[model samples]
Target: MKSVLLALCIVSVSFPALAINRYNVQAMSCASVQQAVKRDGAAILRWQSARNPSLPLYDRYVRNGLYCDPNEYAKRAYVPSQNRANCLVYKCADISDNLLFDD
Candidate 1:
């Protein structure tokens, strides 16, 4: 019983807190955007159907986002405020469509 309790405590202490985050799409590329359907697994993004008439073709794309739980160490380890930024995606950068997460 004592051994088990020690094991549990050590295991918990070693790992960072994993959050069930609703993934946010930081951004997507124009080319990849063609075949893509979602910003993140849970959210969508602006796409070709709504292409802006005035703006020149994009050489790069950018976007933002949300949420997490962290211990003091993790909270400090990350520079961006928790739950305030979305993971970044790139277009025709040949990124895979089935990426599990942006990060």
Candidate 2:
């Protein structure tokens, strides 16, 4: 039982604290929203849709391409914040989208 407990403790300590943060962009200033993503490396920014106020929109924004998957690349995106209609940020997009298809 002691050995199992020791193993569990070691496993817990081996990993860094990588909690994905979520925020309501509408409640935060554009700079605040950007800072959150930069600080966390990645964060889910949520806001209500403009066309449909009842609809919610959210996506994981990243600080840079390093946070994206191998097959994905960072693309410019925007989210609504307290001070701006479109606050610039980056989000992962499928790399295939950039490839040219020859007929």
Candidate 3:
């Protein structure tokens, strides 16, 4: 019993208490912001989308790169004039907007 308890304690402490996958890509240029979104957005969406539908994952979008709005990524519109739209509209959208792949 003591060994089991010790093992459990060790396992718990070995990892972060709150292991959050954060992509703090903020106040960046158009290209940099696009890159960050393209890179991390898909992973974020996958992890978020896999979870229970009741527990939704709230993500933001950088419209004009001045602020980070608490907007659900899926609910955003396609703006042609959008500077960073290439990333959201093309790369991430390629996976999200289309029936590209399941995995």
Best by TM-score: 2
Give one digit per residue, the lDDT tens place, for model 1 in 1-103. Answer: 9999999999887763332122212243333442232343212333221255353322222222122112111011111112323323332222233255533
Instruction: For candidate 3, write residues 1-103 as lDDT tens digits.
Output: 9999999999998764344234423233446545554554432221122246354443443333223223322333222222442234222223244343532
**lDDT (CA) per prediction:** 0.31, 0.90, 0.38
Candidate 2: C-alpha lDDT: 0.90
TM-score of every model versus the real structure: 0.20, 0.77, 0.24
lDDT tens digits by residue: candidate 2, 1-103: 9999999999887753346789999999999999999999999899999999999999899999899989988888989999999999999988887556511
Clashing pairs in 2: none
* Model 1 CA RMSD to the hidden true structure, in angstroms: 15.6
Better of 1 and 3 by lDDT: 3
Off by over 4 Å in 3: 1-26, 42-73, 77-103
Go through the candidates in order and give the C-alpha RMSD of each one to the true structure: 15.6, 4.8, 12.4
Q: What is the lDDT of candidate 1?
A: 0.31
